[model samples]
Target: MSEQRADVIGLGMIGGGVAVSLARRGRVPVVYDIRPDAADHLAGVPAPLASPAEVARASDVVLVAVVDADQARTVLSGEQGLLSGARPGLVVVLLSTVAVPVVRELAETCAKAGVELLDCGVTPGDKAAENGLVAILGGAESTVERATPVLADFAKRVVHCGPLGAGMATKIARNVITYGTWRAVHEASTLAEAAGVDPAKLLTVIDAADPEGATLLSWQRMRLAGKPETRAMVPQVERLLDKDLAAAQDLAGRVGVAVPLVDVARKHGKETLEIRVREDA
Candidate 1:
C-alpha cells in the first residue's frame, strides 16, 4: 500500500469524520457524495471528486460508506460507479452496515471486476474524528492487509474477524446485544418504578451489585459451554423468578400498570432457557 490516503466514496457523518481524521494526519482524501454540497463542510480536508469513478481513478483504495445495501450496489454498479474507473487490484473497503449476504454478493462482484473487497463495519458512528472507531473487518487476509494502512488512519482498533461477511455478522450480533440490553433495562425500570423503587437508585444498586461487570463477562464466557450447568440451574432459577414475577404481577394489578414483558418472561422463562440445554448434556 502507498502512503496516500484512501478515497472516501460518501461524505455522511461517519465518512466525513473519517475524512477529517485522515486529513488531520496530513493525508488528504479524494471525496464524493450524492449530494453536491456535501463536500462544502469539509473544505480544506477533502479534494472533492465528480463521481465515485473519479475517486477510484485517483486512489488505489476507496472506502464506500453509503447508507444501505441498495445505495452500496448503486455506488458500485450504477452509472459513474467506482468500478467504471477502478484499476485491477484496486481495494474497495465497504464500511456500510448491510446484511451479511450483501457483503458476500459484493465480494463476488468485486472479484469479477478484478477488485479486492473487504467488508469493514465500524462502530462509535460519528466519533471517528475525535475517538476513532473499532473496525470490524472481514475478508481474505491479503485483502485485509491491503486496506490496513488506510484503515489505520481512521480506526483506533481494527479486528479481522474472519473471511468474507464475518465482519457484518459480528456487527449484526453486536446490535442485537445493544438494543436487547436496552429493552431489558426499560422493563426493569418500569417494574421498579411501579413497585415504589426509584429507578435511579435501582440503577445504582445494580451497578454496586456487579461493579466489575462479572455477570455479563461470565455469561459471555460460558455462552456455549455452560449447557449442563445451565440445565441444572434452570429449575431453581425458574422457581425464584416465578415467585418474584407473581409478586410483581400482583403489584402491577394493584398499581393498575401493565407489565407485558415481565408477564411473558414469567410464563416462558423455563421454556426459553431450556433451548440452551444441549441434548448430550
Candidate 2:
C-alpha cells in the first residue's frame, strides 16, 4: 500500500521469512540471492531476481540479510552488486549481526555510493516469517524513519537504539545475556545432578520461583531505574551474593561437580550487580 518500494537480498531463513511476511502484508518485495532456487522453499515469495543490482534498481529500501561479513561485502560491493544500481537517495538496511567495526565499514561503503546505510539487528529467526521479530536499528533518525514502514512489514517491534553501530553492539550485548544464562543453567543442573538431586526438580523450583525469569533481569532493571532504595541495598545484596556463591562452590566441591559459571559469577558479582560501596560505609 505504501509508495516506497521494498526489496530483500539473500533469501535464506531470515530473508525468505521477511519476504514472505512482506508479501502477506501486501508489500511483496523484490528479492535476490546467489542461489537461483533460494525462493523455491519460500511460499508467497516471488522468484529471485538475476542480481542484487537488479533488486536495488527496483527498490527504495533494500534489506540485506546475508550470512556473514564476507557475503555481505560481496553482495553489496562485488561485481553487479547493489551499489551498481542504487540511486542517490536509496536506503540500505543491513540485517546481519557483524561486528560494530564491520558495520561502520559497510556504512562508509554505502555512503561513498550516495546511499544511506542502517545497521539492523533482528531476533528470533524462527519467528521471522510470522512477523515476530524485534528490529533493533542504528542510524540517523531520518534514515531510520525512511525505512521503518518497510521494516514494520516483517518486524513486530522496531527500536532505534542509537547512532551507527549501536544496533550491532546492543545485539552482541543481548547475546551475551542469553548465552551466559544458558551456561549458568548448565552449571546449576550439573551441580544438582551431582548432589543427588534431580535436575528436573531444580527446574521445577526455578520455574515456580520465577516463571518468566524476571529475576534474571531484576538487578539490571533496578540499576537502570537508579532507585535510592536499590542503591542503599547494594552492599547487603553484594554480601549475600558472595555468601550464596561461596556456598554453591562448597557444594560443588563436595559433590565433585564443576561449576565454573558459579565461580565466575562469584568473582565478578559486585561488577555484575553494579555494586559500588561507599567509602564511609
Candidate 3:
C-alpha cells in the first residue's frame, strides 16, 4: 500500500482486513487464505489471489498475520511453506504476539535460509488494523526501517522497540497493562455482584467515577450495549493474555523489582483468561 511490493496470507480477519486496506492504496497485493471462498470475496477488488508459496515469490515484503506462533512456523517451514518459494532479501514481518524465545528462534531460522525476520507486532483492535492507525513495535533498527515503508500500508506509526525479541517484549509489556486491567474490572465487578449489589451499578461507578475508568471501558460498554462484539467483549485470547503477565512476572522476579501493584492485577489475569461466556447479544 505504501509504495512497497507486498504479499499477504491469512484472510479471515487479520489477513482480509489488511489486504483490503492495502488494495485501496493502489499497491499490488496478492492474498491467500486456507478458506476456499476467502479470496473469492475480494476477486474484483484487485487483490490477486495466490498460494502461500506463490505469494512468497511474488512480493518483496511479506507480512504474516496468522493466529499463533505455530501458524507462523508452518507458513515458513512446512512443505507448502513460504520458504519453499521465498528468495534471498525477502523480509517477513510477524504481527502476532508470541513468546520471546519463539521469535528469537524464528530470526535464527530465517537467517540460515537467507530471509530476514522482523517482529513488528501491532497494537489495536481489528478496525484499527484496517484503518492503518495501529502501533507497530519492530525488532531491529535496519529491519524496522526497511520494513517501515511497507508496513506503513497498514500502520500509520512504525517504531523500533529495540532488537530482535524486544518488539515482542515491548508488546508483552503493554498487554500487561490492558489485559491486566480488563481482568481487574472482571474481578471488581464480580466482587460487587457477590456482595449483594447490582453489578451494573458497581460497574457504572467504575465506568463513571474511576480515573482509569476508560482503561477497558469499551469492553464494559460493549457487553452492556447488547450482544457484545466478540472482540470488544473479550480483548484477547485468555491464556495467551495471561502469558504476558507471566512474562512480566518472570522479568520482575529476575530484576529484583518489587511490583506490588502488578501482582494484584496478575491474580485477575490468571483467573479470568480461562473463563468463557456465552454471547447473549
Please report, in order, the local distance difference test score of every candidate based on alpha carbons. Answer: 0.83, 0.91, 0.70
After superposition, candidate 2 runs with Cα above 4 Å error? 275-281
Location of the lowest summed lDDT over 10 successive residues in candidate 3:
270-279
- The TM-score values for the models, in the order shown, are 0.82, 0.95, 0.70
- Top candidate by lDDT: 2
Which candidate should be chosen as best, given TM-score against the real structure?
2
Report residue 92 deviation for candidate 3 (angstroms): 0.3
Tens-digit lDDT track of model 1 for 1-281:
35854889888888888888777767778889988888787745655678888988888788899999999999998899989888889999998999999998998888888998999888989687753799999999998887888888889999999999999899888888778778778877887798788999988998999888677556445446657776677678778879988987888888777778778878987765553655665
Writing each residue's lDDT as its tens digit, candidate 3 over 1-281 gives 35568777777566666776676666647766776677566532444454678888887888787889898888888866787788998888887789999998888888887999888767674763365646456566776777777777767677777878888888888888787767766654554555556888976776677657564555445444545344443546555666766775676666555555556656776344332345554
- As for TM-score, the candidate ahead, 2 or 3, is 2
lDDT of 2 by residue, 1-281 (tens): 67899989988889999999998999988899888988887877889999999999999999999999999999999999999999999999999899999999999999999999999999988888999999999999999998999999999999999999999999999999889989999999999899898999999999999999899888887777766677889889999999999999999999898888899889999887784434443
- Would you give me the overall lDDT of model 3? 0.70
Candidates ranked by lDDT = 2, 1, 3
Off by more than 4 A, model 3: 1-3, 42-50, 210-281
Q: Give the TM-score of candidate 3.
A: 0.70
